[model samples]
Target: MPQNRPRRPKVLCLDDEPAVVEGITRTLRKLYDVTGCTKGTEALAVLEADPGFAVVLSDMRMPEMNGAEFLAKARELAPDATRMLLTGQTDLDAAIAAINEGQIFRFLTKPCPPPTLRGAMAAAVAQHRLVTGERVLLQKTLRGSVEVMMEVLGLVSPTYFGRTTRLRHLAADLATALGHPAVWQIEVAAMLSQLGYVVLAPEIAEKVYYGRILDQRERAEVERAWVQAAEMLAPIPRLEPILWIVRNVRRTAADMAHQPGASPDLVRAARILRVAMDFDELLADGRTSAQLAIDTLRGREGHYDEDVLDALEALRGGGQRSRVAEVPVGALAPGMILVEDLALASGMLLVARGYEVTERLLARISGYPADALATDTVRVVLPREQAEAA
Candidate 1:
């Protein structure tokens, strides 16, 4: 068997002058897979086609789009790619604009020596590696930790975990329906939004979960618990954005309207989560149907984002499309959504309706005594794909 060589990092070089682009490619060809383009528009097209480019280098004075404008668009196209600007020694204004607009990693003056250009390309590649490596590490470590925490929540508080799981799916769906970006962050926020309930007395948590009215002191205590949960998660690396959503899941759109430096996406995500959670709770006690719950939310003026509410209303029809069936506990499978509250014969709620079953959830469910369940047959909506197959 032949040993395979490691793949070189891809570098995209763009300039109005074909000769300059060719020069850049020549300097970095040995260490990188270089693609040279004479126009910024053409380079942008290349970037859109293959976002795997590790670095993008552009000259300051391009015909259609200057270096600053090109790199700024490139940032939106391939955020992980490191961008650099090559400018004339007198193009100091353009260099500053590049830094401010494109978040250029580095800028080199024109007539740059081959050795210096090579080193700059090498450094840009290294920066790309650092960014991507940290992202991978964060996903593996932080996301894995979150998964473990959710599993523990299942073990300790199955009811809340079920709510968390359902909310996560709902948040993702609503985000897509609303055409919101960064849907994963909204999903993660939903998954962890109920962490505060873990510390609450079961009765209080159940009341909150079921949307029962709370007294002043009980409401205050619940607020304290939410803050504590956010504090506990604050120590996790790269989790600030998600934590912000979780902490503000209860905040209305108006509440966040005037807050300084608040991101629109984050605000939208928080609103999405808030609506999903409240809607879930409305149906939790089995007293309200989806339409009635939506109506109730609509009546609460300015309490939620109108756009998010519209998305929720639109997604309501999707549930009716799924094929619902009653299955014995043992026959239950992943991807099925619970259609009714899962309870014990003693009338204790184990899991709420709308939860998507998973293997981990099955493991948790198995811990209950056979005779403890209210019924052997449980109602579930088969996932759309499975329903189609059936």
Candidate 2:
């Protein structure tokens, strides 16, 4: 049996001069799979199409775009890719400027020997591996920790965490409707939005959820919960964006956009969370329908992002058309939306109404005893295609 060789890392070389690109590709072809482009825009299109390029090398003086600008855009497209600059000695200042832009991993002068160029690329590849490896590890660690925390919160306060589920679904839908990138971050932020509620008594959280006015002291405690939640997750790696969304989930989009370090994605995620959470609160307070809840939000002028509200309205309108059905717990499937809460015989809520069934949630349901549910059948809304099939 023959063993397969490890795949070579991909390298993208962009230079206005075709000869220069060819020279670099020929120098690095043995160690890497090289793609050469004669224009910065062409390279950028390639990066957008396939983000797996391990290294991006560009000349400092390109007619289409300077090396600094190209590398900076490349950083956005492939954040984990190591970037390098090849510039003439006369353009050394531009190369340094690119470094200051935080986009260049290394810059080599033109007319450089093949040995030196190859060595720099080898180091660049190694750097890419380090960055991507750390990202994967951090994501797995963060996800596992988040799941455990959510489970603990569910056990401690099922009502509050159940609300989190509804918030997550709404936020995710709003994100998709708005065409926002980083929907996962928005969803995860929504899932963890109620972490501060752990500080309050279950009854207090229940009161807040139902939109009952809180006493001054109770309000103070709620404020502390928000701070406590931020403090608890501050130390985790790669959670800054999620934390930003959580901390500002209630802030107006205009306010959040002006805050330090705010980016379009973060602001959009926070806006989506704010709308979903406030909408959910209205429903919890006995608003007759999603339309009514949204109407109330609109009446509160400037309290929410109008774009997010628009997305919410569009999504809710679509959901209203889903066909309703009653199915046994065993027949519940992903993409089905619950019309009523799933609670145990003892009145312990497992999943809240309006919550969409997910594979993960289904797995959790399977752990319940045979007679755990209060009713063998619960009402749900089937997706359009599923309803048609039935």
Candidate 3:
């Protein structure tokens, strides 16, 4: 029989007080690999030097930069590491800000019991694992669903909604450049943010996408779209988090515009998506791609992160065009098609035939010339009658 060894968890503790650090180290050293720091600066250096630490527990009121600031920086540096705030103060505003900005996994007050601290650390580690695993699965699932949803929207308004794939890629690039730990949320949000459009009539969706100013009733209807989107996605387990972010996406932007110091990650993600979606609309409105990207960066205060804007500018300057494969109209089929031009969305190609198109299979085939035969490269589905006749 083989003997089992106890698992040792790595922990980084930051506190200005030597006595407190000593006490925590003594209590946790038996089960955890503890690294203690007296200041945020030193802790950051230690974290930079050692990336193996699984959890960071920091005191709230420290000199130079407080725990929230330290945790915010830590999130960028070691996104997989769990973050927690330990504070003696009971300030509600500060607590909310810390959770929102630093994305702290747990909050603990001074004089915490050894058992309580242990429990919190355990929970934080578990959460870190859960979040990472969920993101991987979500990305895989999203790779397919996002295209389907976006194509549906494109069918409603090709000129405006056709750039969904572009907006998603832009949002992801911006989020990564800005060092957002929850970049997955930004990706999912950008992919599905316009889900509310599905509820509205095609004309309404077009009006919203084309920058047409909405009247009072239209504004109300548009606002309600978020709630409707949330309701629509509530049934799915994976979509719940995205729904939360999407519901609050607008509010996050408004908050950032008013309060610059708040939740930079959330604000940055929302801003990127907002600007990217709006830029696509601008392109739809006859503005050139380069000009649209440049104008978007220059026009607004709370529209996008400066680094993201710079990246977009670089993308434009580098002539980074989307490669879409075009299938001849004569060879069109009932499957997927990759448009080889940058005229519309770039990234994933089109799913040529879905439920709606399947129903109209005969109508589509009737329009094709008798001599025209579908090519294998074009990806087509044959109607049962056509297959039987052949």
lDDT of each: 0.85, 0.85, 0.68
Give lDDT tens digits, candidate 1, residues 1-390. 457988999999888998888878778888899999998889889998988999998888877989999999999888899999888857667778899999999989889999999888889999999999987787667666787789777767878888887888888899888867577778778888889889999889988988889999899989999999998898887888898888777766777656654788788888888899888888887878889999999998878878878788888865534788899987889999888778889997777776778897788779888899898989999988888888
Q: Which stretches of candidate 1 lie over 4 Å from their true place?
A: 1-10, 22-52, 113-118, 176-181, 257-261, 295-301, 319-322, 367-369
Task: Tell me the deviation in Å of residue 102 in model 3.
Answer: 11
- Scored against the true structure, residue 351 in model 1 reaches a CA lDDT of 74
Alpha-carbon RMSD, each predicted model: 3.4, 3.7, 9.8
The CA-based lDDT of model 3 is what?
Answer: 0.68
In terms of lDDT, model 2 sits at 0.85
Q: What's the TM-score of every candidate structure?
A: 0.84, 0.83, 0.55
Q: Higher lDDT: candidate 1 or 3?
A: 1
lDDT of 3 by residue, 171-220 (tens): 77766766666777788787778777767775677687667777888888
Candidate ranking (lDDT, best to worst)? 1, 2, 3
Arrange candidates, best TM-score first.
1, 2, 3
**Model 2, 1-390: lDDT tens per residue?**
347888999999999999998898899999899999999999999999998999999888888888899999998898789999888857656767899874688878888799999999999999999988977787677767786678667766767767877787788878887867577788889888988988887778878878899999989889998999999989987799999989887777778888877998898788778888889888886546889998999999988878888888888887544689999999999999887778999987887676677787789889988697898999998987898888
Candidate 1 RMSD computed on C-alpha atoms after optimal superposition onto the true structure:
3.4
Give the least accurate 10-residue stretch of model 3, judged by summed lDDT: 336-345
lDDT of 2 at 2: 46
